[model samples]
Target: MATMNRQHHLRGVLLASVACILWGISGVAASSLFMLNPHITALWLTQVRMISAGMILLVFGQFAGVKPFAIWRQRATALRVVSYGLLGLVPVQLCYFEAVKFGNAPIATIIQYLGPFIISIYFLLFKHVTPTRPEALGMIMAFFGTLLIVTHGHLNSLAISPVVLFWGGLSAIGVATNTLLPRPLLPKFGAVSVTGWGLLVAGICLNVFGPVWQDHVTLTGAELALILVIIILGTVIPFLMFAHALGYILPTTASLLDAFEPLAATVFSVAFLNVQLTNYDLFGGMLIILAVMALSLNGRKMINFLRSFRTE
Candidate 1:
């Protein structure tokens, strides 16, 4: 029993780490595409990503006996699906891409780490739940970390443009909303069904603004391959792996391992994209990751608090 438990723990860690690494790499892949085609907009990339990944995951859900369309049986659930898609998933996808476009992936990813802090604040304001000591400390760390990144440790000047900061801040809200909104649906419909449908709905909605097929950006063979990698390796596989790993390990453990995402993003951005980072960037990023780690220590309380928001 002990050996089997140990094996499951190790498997969980590996799955979580690889999922985070792939997520980080996917951001770099998006950054590479942005660099390759200055004409490529984050809106277009997000639409394509949501549409393609949604369809693929829906197909996978069917094969897995998940009954993807069953989520639409009830009006409430159907509406929730649409809301989750539009308000939760779409913003995260679109804003994240925009952040990456304006800044590098590392900056975007680290900023998105503010999601937990946002959640904590929500609990305080709305739920009347006070954050535990660890949660409070983590929030302070995240604030200072983000401050360092924006100011480069100097309040007089900004390191990144205000535009990047704006989108990145919105992206963090998107992350928090996405994390919060999907809790009720996952158990009933399964992550595969909820996520797949949510993506498709968001994609369809985005299409009303501008269809991807109408976009006129020319793609080389290499860029096409990178898009495929972003869709498959970056989005779909990592999501599946991370979700599955949750079954084998504690949520706290999985959340801690997710810190690898920023590290992977920074490494890949520097190594592949040749993006430069200063000491302030590295140190700020470190603090943000540490904040995430601290929050992960309070994962159980956070989960319970989030669950309080779920409808009966």
Candidate 2:
């Protein structure tokens, strides 16, 4: 039983890793979308992506004996799904793409990584949770690292635009809420179904305001194909994997592992987006990476250390 549990744990980690990896590379696709058409708003793109991917997940799950519309049958479940959709799905996806739109992929990716730090603070204050030394230090490092990146080690001029900063911060909050909102629903309907329903709700909300069918798409075939990648690989697949991960591990742990998204986004940003880095940027990035690695590996110890300070 122990070995089986270990195997499940390892598998969960792998799934979470894959999810984050896909999310990391998603910046590349989003970056390409902005380049595809300066006129294509993230709003419209997101609406389309959500609606399509939601449909796909709902349809596909039927083959696996999963009743996609089962949530709609229950008033409470339906309400939760709607809430998760409007609150969770929209913010995380929309703000991320908007950040990527305003800033380059690397900047958007790194800034959004503030999710874990935000989570830590929330737990410490609201949940009265304690982090070990490693996690506490890691959170501190991540905070300063993010500040360094944004301010470029100086407060005079931010490295990215103010708008990017706003969107990025919102994206981080969205990530936190995204991870938190689905906990109740996951145990009831499983990952894919909950995600599908949430996405569907988000899609309905988004499309309610945007003219989906009437809007003329100026995207070339190649751009549409890239958007498809954003819809399927980035949105659908990763959410499913991460949702599955919640069953096996804590959401905080999954969020910790999500540091890879920034790294992966950085690589693609440099290689494809031609985003150049400076020494300060590299230093700051290293700080964030090291902190994430530390916390993810042994967060409980750090949480405990943090608790000691509060006690003293």
* Residue runs of model 1 more than 4 Å from their true location after superposition: none
What are the models' TM-scores?
0.98, 0.86
Count of backbone clashes, every candidate in sequence: 0, 10
* Candidate 1 lDDT tens digits, 1-312: 999999999999999999999999989999999999998999999999998999999999999999999999999899988889998888787898899999999999999878878878887898888888988888888888888999987899999989889888888888888988878888899998999999999988998888888999899999999999999999899989998999899888988987888899999899888899998899998988998899888878777766666755
Model 2 misplaced regions, further than 4 Å? 1-14, 130-132, 242-256, 298-312
Report the Cα lDDT for candidate 2.
0.80
RMSD of 2: 4.6
Q: Tell me how far the alpha carbon of residue 203 in candidate 1 is from the true structure, in angstroms, after superposition.
A: 1.1
lDDT of 1 at 252: 84
On the 0 to 100 scale, the lDDT of residue 19 in model 2 is 94
Candidate lDDT (C-alpha), each? 0.90, 0.80
Residue-level lDDT of model 2, residues 1-312, one tens digit each, is: 999988888888899999988888878888988987887888888888888888888887887778777878888778878888888888888898899998878788877777766767777887777777888899889888887888887888887789998998888888777766776766567777888878878977887777777678788898888888888898788877887887787655775678778888888888887888877777787788778777667766434544453343
- Candidate RMSDs in order: 1.0, 4.6
How well does candidate 1 score on lDDT at residue 174?
A: 86
